[model samples]
Target: MVLLEMSIVPLGQGESVSQYVARCVEIIERSGLSYELHAMGTIVEGELGQVLDLMRQCIEEVAKSANRVTCTAKIDYRQGVTGGIRSKVASVREKLGRVAGPN
Candidate 1:
């Protein structure tokens, strides 16, 4: 089960947080994938690729309804027990150390 962290930035239309989140939930449901949408402001999480794709589609649909409306998405996958991507990368770096220059 892949976990994803996403941030969606809505433009143009003055959409409330609840409204935007509701729209996102609807889109995810339509995608035929099981997901959980957390209401913690801008950031959201769920299944990896599926949720992100649905979020993009929802944003597009919303934009079509409102002039100049657009949204940007950022997604990151969770590695293991720890949630943060930075923590995961740091763990990897500690194991690998710095690479030597090619001779």
Candidate 2:
């Protein structure tokens, strides 16, 4: 599986971008990909092609109402690797001898 940390910004939108963010997240959820929403962005895990397609869909969807849209994505593609979203965090916490907790 591939992991993507994606942040979509709708330019020209007012100070609060909750609407656009919600819409983008709606797109993510509708795609049926596993994801985690964070303060700065969303993390999605899926196949490479699907994740890229999702990014394209996000840009296009936001562009429908947004004058300009900026998308930032951090992709982690690992062959024969899966489920890094939760496990990766757990690995680090284990190394630090700590338990999982709310962020």
Candidate 3:
């Protein structure tokens, strides 16, 4: 599995871009892939192709509504690991001797 942290922004969409963010989140949700939305970006877990395709979809959708769009993505892939979205965080908290909060 692959873990991808992605942020899609529609440029010149005024100061608040919550609506655009919401639209991207909606696309991610519809993909049926496991995902978590954070303040700066969203993390999604799936195969590399699936995740990349989803990212493309978001960019395409946002471009239709804005003059320009910017997207950033960071991907992590482990040879034999899955569920890094939650497990990666849990691993860190465990080493710190603390239980993870809501995943």
Backbone clash count for every predicted candidate, in the order shown: 0, 0, 0
Estimate TM-scores for all models: 0.47, 0.93, 0.94
The 0-to-1 C-alpha lDDT of every candidate, in the order given, reads 0.55, 0.90, 0.90
Better of 2 and 3 by TM-score: 3
Please report, as a residue range, the 10-residue window in candidate 1 with the lowest summed lDDT. Answer: 79-88
Model 3 C-alpha lDDT per residue in residues 1-91, reported as the tens digit of each score: 8999999888888878778888989999999999998999999999999999999999998899998999989999877898788888899
Candidate 3: stretches off by over 4 Å: none
lDDT string, candidate 2, 7-96, tens digits: 888888877877878988999999999999989999999999999999899889889998898999999998888889888998899899
lDDT of 1 at 39: 52
- Give the poorly placed runs of model 1, Cα more than 4 Å off: 41-49, 68-103
Task: Look at candidate 1 and give me any clashing residue pairs.
Answer: none
Sliding window of 10 residues with minimal summed lDDT for model 3: 12-21
**In model 1, what lDDT does residue 72 have?**
49
